[model samples]
Target: MADFNLSLFDTSPFFLTGIPGLESAHIWISIPFSMFYIISLLGNFTILFVVSKEQTLHKPMYMLLCMLALTDIGLPTSVVPKALCIFWFNLTSITVGGCLTQMFFLYIFSGMQSAILMAMAFDRYVAICNPLRYTTILTNARIAKLALVGLLRALLIVLPMPLLLSRHPFCANRIIPNTYCNHIGITKISCVDTTVNRMYALVAVLVFVGIDLTIIAGSYILIIRALFRISSKQTHQKALNTCTAHIFVMLMFYPPFVFSTLTYRFGQGIAPQIHIMLANFYFVAPPMLNPIIYGVKTKEIRDKVFKYSCRM
Candidate 1:
């Protein structure tokens, strides 16, 4: 029996906890998660479809928005369905390869989202700070180039993570206490030292996400200065109003992200279920809210959505 157990350790699937301490209530928990997933899918897809079909929407801001929509779609889709399966169908076991695949997509989309948000902030910066040069600086070709660079950066950064993780043999324990596979969670179950994995994860967040947030803050500072310099109150109000949606979306994303990361690293006294729930929220809330915020706040998008719906 001991030998059999040893043999199984190397080949066994990792079991997901799916909100620990609330196993009995997984059915109830899945209801809200499912609803959020559906809303995110519909909202982001609508944005993509509308943006692609309308020629008037082909500008730097809208292009960046479409990139955002793509990340929103990819981010949740990479994890939510698997989580729903765990919650609803008891399909909690995932192979090592499958878990790594899930982690790769999850991190890649997250990285891309951060880069795109920074790009959007720059778009607003150019539009407000140097309105005359906005068109010349952010042409269609330039927007495409920006999108490509963001994708490549995310790909290069995240591609190494899964490769690094795959080298470690996960034999002793195969149970992950979260609904989805993440780098840290997987590393915790490994038999050997995972200092390299943990350090790389920390470096990636500190370098990539840290830099993105700093640039975004700087852009907003310049934007505010430019807004105050405007002589016309109406123009100032209009410009500020244009930025409200992006700010709100950023708020939805970064706060929960920071909380989740900090809690995971330092909040050892916190309840496992609470940490799990907040982490799930970090993955889901931004995608679900971004399109709705943009739709209601951006007049062109709101109008296009209304017209498209009316025709449908």
Candidate 2:
């Protein structure tokens, strides 16, 4: 039997399995996955382009939408291309440094998207709860500052992850049985003690997702209570209508995220393939669905999309 704790000093390439327990069907699976990649890229890029060129979109809400589009583009861009290569071309080997780089970008961008969502929630809260003062409250300067703060927060929170993992000696299995270099997935294969990494991972999740979710839920709760106080049905409907896209997009995001996180933290007995599938869904689904939800629900974006489509 091979020793599980044998530490090697040489830097060998880690083999990445595209999706465990379904390696034989990777070619077939890559079809929808390819479509997802195409749609995600095209959709998010179109959102960025449209929001940038249209002067009417230069508002706090759309500014946050642009932030979201960028993060959506980034979150999947960090993982999917390498996954596509693994699925289609059998390119599974990645160096330790390379894997660490991928892990860094993945965590940072994922955290960024969550932060952007919180910002969007705040935007809606201001718009609905304090309608007359919306513009005064969320000025361009404040929006810019919020965006910068979000990026900085994501950086500070996820920065420790790669550093912690890099110092650890990996003497166990070099084969990572998932599409991308996830923090948990990579750390599990390390030979040395990973308790610090695990603890910090929990801390990162709590600080980012846990705290953000609480704030977002609080904002919406206040918005809901304010809505109930208004006597006019037309005003209530109009206010709710404005939030439809954000609400739908949130639905597309958090459930899959919570499911994947739960599976990762607690579902050790779950099949590797299931874990990989949920992770892929968490990465791929939201980016592809976000623009679609906004385009369908928001009249301004929808009309602009149609106008641009006709011109081109």
Among all windows of 10 consecutive residues in model 2, the one with the lowest summed lDDT is 1-10
Query: For each predicted model, how many residue pairs clash, with residues at least 3 apart or on different chains?
Result: 0, 0
Q: Count steric clashes of candidate 1.
A: 0
TM-score of each: 0.95, 0.95
lDDT score for candidate 2 against the true structure: 0.86
lDDT of 1 by residue, 1-312 (tens): 333223223556888889999999999988888898899989999999999999999988998999999999999889899999999899999887788889999988988889988999999999899899999999989989988998899889888888877777775668899999988898888787899989988888887779999999999999999998999999999899988999998988888777887788889999999989888867777898999999999999999999999997
Candidates in order have lDDT scores of 0.88, 0.86
Question: How does candidate 1 fare on TM-score?
Answer: 0.95
Rate residue 178 of model 1 by lDDT: 94
On lDDT, the leading prediction is: 1
Which pairs clash (backbone N, Cα, C closer than 3 Å) in model 2?
none
Model 1 worst lDDT window (10 residues): 1-10
Model 2 segments more than 4 A misplaced: 1-10
